[model samples]
Target: MQSQILPSRAALVDRIALQFEYGQNLIVLLGTSGLGKSYLLETFITDKYNDFNKAFVQVGAQMTDVQLMTQLLEQSFNAPLIDHNLSLSQNYYQLAKQQQCGACLWVIDGGRHLSEELIAELELLSKSAPNVLYIMIASQSKLPFKEVVNIHLEPLNLVESKQLMGWYFT
Candidate 1:
């Protein structure tokens, strides 16, 4: 398969891989529109951790905290097994306690659309959960939580832009 990791993004990809390798569980990828935040998330997961059980969820504009959490939990685990009676946090806590899920990675896209409250909650869960890594691709840089690995992406420079274009047109 052709590589999704572009020439300009190689360094960023390497840095992220290093961070994840060294036990960086909670990562927030912050970048402006058109900077390939979502693309980077997908590439990083697929290229680096394809063996992991993944829940790729897009956060919609009107989605509530409960909706977001349920979607992640349901996708990560089979919905039929999850206890709908329990609150979302309780359900998440229960799953973490099970310790049966090995190497689960959640890639949450469209994070800028969600409220900061929801983002903070997700960060907390990611920090607390074992064997689960959360990478949120967002334009927003300000996070309620302090202990997070924030990887910011920048637009490619003119030379690098030409190199990226060369990969497509050559």
Candidate 2:
């Protein structure tokens, strides 16, 4: 299937792009389960990847803070491991500074399962890498950080619903 979001959703995409361009680093995608939240975020990333280095990781319920940071570092910077002595915020800053790659977009899907400590680390990472856009997909607004840019996705309307069905049936 084509990784395209509906034109009706263009406003949301535009808003995200505008805010990210204007220095909004942490973006939270909130919606009820099965509301196409992941689809929307994926389409946005696919559409915008040409402009930024992109990485994505789906967090599991049992993942530890160190594992989360390791995954992020590997996915975003292709690094094997983060320096244990450095704080998460420091690692993020060091990675951003060392990587010659342009701005990065890090998508953490299934964020609802992350522990409070991991989320807090994410907040610190955002501050350290101002140019890196961190988007978290969660079922609710439970992020520890208050300065996040929240995007609430609504379910598809009738017209869009019919179109999606047609795409599958035709």
Candidate 3:
């Protein structure tokens, strides 16, 4: 993701921006619930990216691999997965490599809930597609993948929360 330093948006966002500046393909935002993982991801995307090809998927508990790709197809490519003829892997890869397709970004919330199939496919996509970037907001603290740049967001303390509220109401 291309970026430029701008207005104040917390140190966390700035850190992630630096990671993007390093040209990493996959970045995982790790934080517990209520730590605003989703907020950070959305804010980062909003502040930095201006591209039209971006996929935003919220991973549900029961989501299947097909469901995952279906959302990606719908959001980024505007190509719904109606045909049962092709596998999810083939469909996304074909669309992603299309001559008309621009650089794509995938922002997945609750990424820890993703199934193994989804994870495997994502790794494959990252390897094959040079124009795609993925940001996964997960609550786990582990950095299992050596290729994934992990950014951990700490929860706000009580006083910090009060300070934030003050900033909000001012």
Candidate 4:
């Protein structure tokens, strides 16, 4: 796992770990493309945490809010359904409520692709739910959601970059 660490991400990961350890519920990791934000997120969740019901959503440029919600619901519930009548936002909200009995962590990657409306819907869902931790990755800092803790991931420093190369390539 050390090999997987990148210099640009070590300090951010340390900060995130500290926040998580302190029970900070929502964190938004902001970075540009190809900066290893997603990789760092994966490493954090896989290596540092357990007992969290995890849902990972990959946002596509062509995806609709409904489609995104449907995908999120499917991942969270491990269910397959073909209900065109039910709006995806409604379904997602309901599912979040149901999942809130336990600790639930949702990782939304490429969130910049989501429409403002869908982002707002997600924000509402997270805000209304008591035990939901939403971690979003985006290229920039602007998010349609509110009350989110933003962590900006800048490019790695020289030492950190070398460390990351060593961790991932060794």
Candidate 5:
């Protein structure tokens, strides 16, 4: 189960591991559908920390900007209704700031479904939070954040794919 077919990618994985260990604030994983981006992120997060404060948000096809922001805020804060008065965007930014202060790893999946406003807010948070790690999984690169280490995930090579299949199918 523990094998990798893309022997050339060993260096890439090592680089990513080093960045994570050195406290890089943002890591962007980009690839097409069915590339196992989510699986890789999940495996890395789970392997990294037992009690990691990880938040997962899957953007729906019909999700609006407000809805996306609210979902992100809710998941990050663990609060069902966070401030009824503030707008969804406002609440989301606030929650992101708070999470960054707490040094939590925020994983945003399906970010391509988010609206422009949500993306802007995420860019702002990425800039402001030095300690907060934001891992974004998207079909392509569209992040407005600067200095984001982008990893273009391809299908695992033969050896790695076989290992993954065996691990899951067994």
Candidate 6:
């Protein structure tokens, strides 16, 4: 498969990998749309495929907190359905704690759409499972917590942009 090698993107991926290697749990990627955030994340995931059991959740503006949480629980753990909020979160935390996957990575794209409550639930997950990593792909929206390491992605430079366009057209 072919890939676009942009310096900013490569650097962002390196920074994220280094942080995870050093035991950081929450890493946020912030950039405007079309900044290659998803592509960078895909590259990172592919490179770390052997080290983590990764789950990618694409957040949409229409999804509610319950829906988002349910999607995550189903995708990552497949735990039984539970109605109560606390029970649902606890179940997810328990499964994360028991994860045998060398490390578990939860990558949420379009994370700006996630409600504050859902974000809090993610924070709870980080607290419960130190072996798990949360990579949130946000556009302009700031993370609520101060603890998260926010990596801002810059748009492609003239040369990189021309190369990308040339590759796309040719």
lDDT of predicted model 6: 0.68
Superposition error at 88 for model 6 (Å): 5.7
Those runs of model 4 whose alpha carbons end farther than 4 Å from true positions after fitting are 1-3, 17-24, 78-89, 96-101, 167-170
Query: What TM-score should be assigned to candidate 3?
Result: 0.78
Top candidate when judged by TM-score against the true structure: 2
> How well does model 2 score by local distance difference test?
0.71
Cα miss at 72, model 1 (Å)? 1.1
Task: Give Cα distance to truth, residue 104, candidate 3, Å.
Answer: 1.4
Q: In model 2, what are the clashing residue pairs, if there are any?
A: none
The alpha-carbon deviation from the true structure for residue 13 of candidate 6, after best TM-score superposition, in angstroms, is 0.7
Candidate 5 off by > 4 Å: 1-14, 21-23, 50-52, 78-89, 92-101, 130-133, 140-146, 168-170
Best by lDDT: 2
lDDT of 6 at 127: 61
lDDT of 4 by residue, 1-170 (tens): 43456544666677876875565656777777777778876776576556766677777788777777666666656454535566654665555555543565677788778777766666666656555555445545567567767887777678877765775587
lDDT (0 to 1) per candidate: 0.71, 0.71, 0.67, 0.65, 0.62, 0.68
Pairs of residues at least 3 apart in sequence or in different chains that clash in candidate 6: none
Residue 135 displacement in candidate 4 (angstroms): 3.2
Q: lDDT per residue, candidate 2, 25-87, as tens digits?
A: 778888888777677677666776576777777777787777777777776675545896776
Per-residue lDDT over 1-170 for candidate 1, one digit per residue giving the tens place of the 0 to 100 score = 23746666878877877887787777778877788887877775577677777777787778777777778787676542567566555677788676466677778787777676666666676677655565545555545656788778888889877877887897
Q: Which rank order by lDDT, best down to worst?
A: 2, 1, 6, 3, 4, 5
Candidate 6's residue-wise lDDT over 15-102, tens digit each? 7878876867777888888888777767755666455566777788887777766666666654545455564457675665565434
Flag regions of model 3 displaced more than 4 Å: 1-9, 80-88, 141-146, 157-159, 167-170
- Residue 78 in candidate 5 has what lDDT? 61
* Model 6: lDDT of residue 101: 35
Error of 1 at 92 (Å): 1.9
Q: List pairs with backbone clashes in candidate 1.
A: none
